[model samples]
Target: MASGKPIDEKVRSEIITKIRDEGMTVTEASNRYDVGKTAIYTWMRDGVVNSTSSLILENNRLKKENEQLYNLLGRATVELKKSKR
Candidate 1:
């Protein structure tokens, strides 16, 4: 027998919402909805998650920390050079 008919936009939106809200893994979602993992990944990459998404917030935080660390290192290098002169 053939696979069931393709799901509609409503169902697709619900699935995407579930994936984002529940932090469901692509593999789990694929198995549950009979959707391909690649399709799920494509949805995620296509802006399914909002700007205030936790992952994006955490990424921004990490980038800020990285810049701070680099600035500190540069200052330390400058101090070392002055001390050596």
Candidate 2:
């Protein structure tokens, strides 16, 4: 039977976490949390958008770090060449 009540954000987050981080399947989470499979699927879709945003941010940060490392290496190479000359 449906609870006929809204699930709270905290509970929703826990359910999502279990599915994403704990390797729980959608069916398992739906059963364990007493939520509908459709709701869990919707949550997973929404989470993918958020995860994509986070991945973009992380990729930008890594690009900057890589650029800085390349610059540092170039400077070190120049200094090494100067010392050799």
Candidate 3:
């Protein structure tokens, strides 16, 4: 609970969750939990970067899947046209 001291991982997670999910302000959490504002800000920034990375990977995967589906549809359409002719 002190600055420069190692905080427990569960407690750190709870503090971050309070700031994010419960809408607790950085100043408030710092004061309430006796943590430094800088530490909390760092945690938030790290979380954002990690989340963005995950989103980018997921988006890329979905794009590939969509392209594959389109290719399959195009092939099916071509086969249908040939059968009709």
Candidate 4:
């Protein structure tokens, strides 16, 4: 930090990503970066990171899988119709 304050923005972001995105605990991230737990908690309080990204990725992946399955079902339906005729 420029002054006797918290960590820099880049460092804070990295800490957030390491903890939230990489699934590391606050304690783990603190120890890995040698930062204090209080600082991590403060950044979290300011909404520096959240669990929404993980959920969004999971939802998008599931949506893609669902679309593929729907396409497969449609193709199977068409094949069945042709076989019956």
| Alpha-carbon deviation at 79 in model 4, angstroms | 32
For TM-score, candidate 1 versus 2, the one ahead is 2
lDDT order of candidates, top first: 3, 2, 4, 1
Per-residue CA lDDT of model 2 for 1-85, tens digit only, reads: 2365787777877887788889999888778878888887886777635555576689999999999999999999999999999
Tens digit of per-residue lDDT, candidate 3, span 1-85: 5568876766777888788889999999999999888888887777634554576689999999999999999999999999999
Question: What is each predicted model's overall lDDT from 0 to 1?
Answer: 0.74, 0.80, 0.82, 0.78
What is residue 24's positional error in candidate 1, in angstroms?
1.5
Query: Candidate 3: what lDDT?
Result: 0.82
Off by over 4 Å in 1: 1-5, 48-85
* lDDT preference between candidates 1 and 2, better one: 2
| Model 2 stretches with alpha carbons more than 4 Å out | 48-85
Query: Which one wins on TM-score?
Result: 2
TM-score of every model?
0.45, 0.54, 0.53, 0.48
Better of 2 and 4 by TM-score: 2
Considering only N, C-alpha and C atoms within 3 Å, which residue pairs clash in candidate 3?
none
